[model samples]
Target chain A: MPGINTSSLPDIIFMLLFFFMVSTTMREVTVRVKQRMPEATEVQKLEKKSLVSFIYIGEPKNTKLFGTKSRIQLNDVFASVDDIPEFIAKEREARDEADRKFITTSLKVDGNTKMGIVTDVKQELRKSGAFKINYSTRKKVERRSR
Target chain B: MARRAAPEINAGSTADIAFLLLIFFLVTTTMDVDTGITRKLPPPVENPDEDVDVKERNVLKILVNSHDMLMVDGKRSDVRLLKDKTKDFMALHPDNPDYPEITTKFIEELGKEFPASKGVISLKNDRGTSYEMYIKVQNELARAFNEMKDERSVELFGVKYSQLVDENKIKAINKLVPVRISEAEPEDIGGK
Candidate 1:
């Protein structure tokens, strides 16, 4: 005669589920922008980030404003220096809930863009009260012209 | 034996579900990677380093005023002109031909011309200027410096871009070229 002994199975399952939920991390939202990253052969990788923010460099179409270049998106777009701290703060709050440390940001500046704009973003981030910032860069891909 | 054995509540199915959920989350979790130019910032000063005489010549001072005015080396200049002048300042062997990265060129040129001058870029921005422009300046400066370093290795040292490019070497050189970005106080820039 077979018997069903059922007490440890539930406990084991609950433990496993709880472990996964705590260990799991959500994917960060990234914005599309071209960046000329500094050439560093040996770059140290950073693991923890409180917030990840992206700044896109380029002019908005038909906008006289300094930072606004395109007419499409606002959330993805950061028009001026004043907008940085707010974005960083919001990201900080999100990260804080998860017990994260510092806010991290990536500024993607176009090759044709002016250097002043890059400096502006850096300065803003520094003042935005978030000390840590990451500028994104792509590995140089060798393209063979067909 | 017939009166024993309370009803068995099998919780095995729930346990299996929990285990599966845990595995799923572990597989789906994403990681964050941080990247950028690393520079050792000067420690904060209580009284501030007032005696530090920051030279205007060797140190490229990029000033963006409230009205979007760009100033290089204390003189107000257009962005295009600034780029050209910066290139000229960095270009060491004008007659040798083949322009290199502007920042690297500038450093090499400075090293040759002003041997005692420490090659550094000090960025100062007016309080009222928009933030977007500030980042642009920093990026351009870093780009310019990086370009100069790359060009110097190629043109001066005969190291082509295709050569065994050691990234550590580039980073080493970049580390020496420190950047000090300073912002004018509210009273200094007439900002509220």
Candidate 2:
């Protein structure tokens, strides 16, 4: 029996590689907090990723250093509520003048976290003039009733 | 002289190179789409003490205690019943003084006057309330508003609200059934 040709294997591999590269996005910030986002039925896909800045809220992975309290994360570092305005300003400055108005702050708060910290973050965001915000949540699938 | 055929380039290592790059991308990237409940925060008030004089009947107050118990319009209610309750509250019940008063306004996009509910959902939660419960309450309120919009869209355009792609039609629907959920500052209710 003649050996089967395997010349198309490289092309197939390259196709898969290209698909992954196009569909996936690079993880921008290293998440120091343990974030388990809450589930919700009413969710809209965040459009224009460039215009979205993320704020992570959850207990730190290293409990020894950061304590048990929920900490706010802006970019790669753990930040307090006071740092949010500066973070917003920095984010705004990074973008073009036209795109500055379109910036949205996405809050990825852990489900188990208390509302007090979240509210504080929200108040800080309000003072900073970041009116548009999104609560990052996983899509909850509902079971059909008979 | 007969032209010699060019040698075929070796392609066996291409698969290895592709595999290496694919692994790199797989390690560095994430496939999950960022989805969430979008909201607009009201601008910071100049005078925090000054209260807006909204009529008593127009506001539907929803409170979530630290224990995750729900209180809707001063009545203890289940989370499952919230959507239906909100829908009923916002419905055009002109004769019912308990329900929100309706104001008919001329919508430019629709080119017809429609009754818009003056109802506003006020959500207040305790400082110790879990984020999960807050999101659940928010989801229910959003669902109620979405259903109202869908109902109106079907009656006017013969299609579901999500199915309507026209910008003006969407704007008209939004104007007809506005999502007026006002979240209040977290209080230290029900103790820490």
Candidate 3:
């Protein structure tokens, strides 16, 4: 018996692999801040990927490099509150006019973080009219029944 | 047709090219999934000094200090009991002749005050308060509204709040007990 030709094996695997790549979103940034999200029972899954921008707040992941300070991360850059409006404006411009109204700012903050920076971030977002804010959290784990 | 056999095309190189591209994308693809709790921030007021006065009776004040302790309506409260207390405060059918959800019999049973239409939840926290505690309180308040909406949904439409697809039905449920959370500016307890 002759051996079967398997020349198209890689092609078959690539097609499936490509589908997975295209179907899922790529991680856009490396988080330099350490974040442990809080848990909430009323969590909602954000439906649209396009209309959301992320803001990460926590202590520096490399505590030695940034001195264990809580920092604000917008995209790949560490930013101050002054940069928030410009960031949101840029984000808004990337969206279609019709979809702009639905744009959301997702806040991923460490549970142990103080509210000082979070409050400032919220104020800046409000000034930018990025009123749709999502607090990233985990679903409440059921520990007991009534 | 034996003399016209189709020319054999090579597919060997195509596999290598695909393999390279596949590896690139496979490594770049992110498996991290993100989900969250969404809140709409009220548009900022022009003047911080200009404010409307709310009756003390119609407001439930929740203060989270630096210690992550909860003060609900001036009383110290456990994080766990926040939900039930919020639910009790949000109870609509506690015997109001006007709302009818608060039937006299219902009020007689539960012994709750007549639910107020103009009730507001004022959430204030010290800057030193942990985000964890803040989020938990928010979750409880949101759950209070959600549970009411869900209960009303079941009574009216025999479905869960999320399953009520009609916009009008949703509006009606919301009108029953409008979500009126007022988050106050945090006090600078972090000393920043």
Error of 3 at B5 (Å): 6.5
**B1-192 per-residue lDDT for model 2 (tens digits):** 999999999988988999999888778777788999999999998997899989989999999888899999899999999999999999999878999998998899979898878899999999888999999989888999999999999999999999999999999999898899998865666677
- Candidate DockQ values, in order, are 0.18, 0.80, 0.68
lDDT of 2 at A77: 94
Give the runs in model 1 whose Cα sits over 4 Å from its true position: A1-25, A28-132, A135-146, B1-41, B90-119, B160-168, B175-187
Model 3 segments beyond 4 Å from truth?
A1-11, B1-7, B12-16, B93-116, B189-192
lDDT tens string, model 3, A1-146? 98888876977978877797786677878998988999887888887888889999999888888887789998998999899999999999999999999998999999989887899899889888999999999776767677
- Which digits, one per residue and each the tens of the lDDT, describe model 3 over residues B1-192? 458877888877877888777788877777655777788898888988887776675677899988889999889999788878777765654444322233222233223333435567889998888899899899888888888789878976799889988887776666665687898854565464
Kindly give the number of clashing pairs for every candidate.
Answer: 34, 0, 4
Interface RMSD of 3: 1.9
Residue-level error in angstroms, candidate 2, position B23? 2.2
Q: Which number leads on TM-score?
A: 2
Query: Model 3 TM-score?
Result: 0.86
Candidate 3 residue B7 C-alpha distance from true site, Å: 4.3
Q: Once model 2 is optimally superposed onto the true structure by TM-score, how far is the C-alpha of residue B22 displaced, in angstroms?
A: 1.9
Query: Which lDDT value does model 3 have at A45?
Result: 88
C-alpha lDDT of candidate 1 relative to the true structure:
0.52
What lDDT would candidate 3 get against the real structure?
A: 0.81
lDDT tens digits, residue span A1-146, model 1: 87877767778677767776776666543443433443333233444543555566644533544344421111555456667668767766766565544445655554445445555555666566556555444332334553
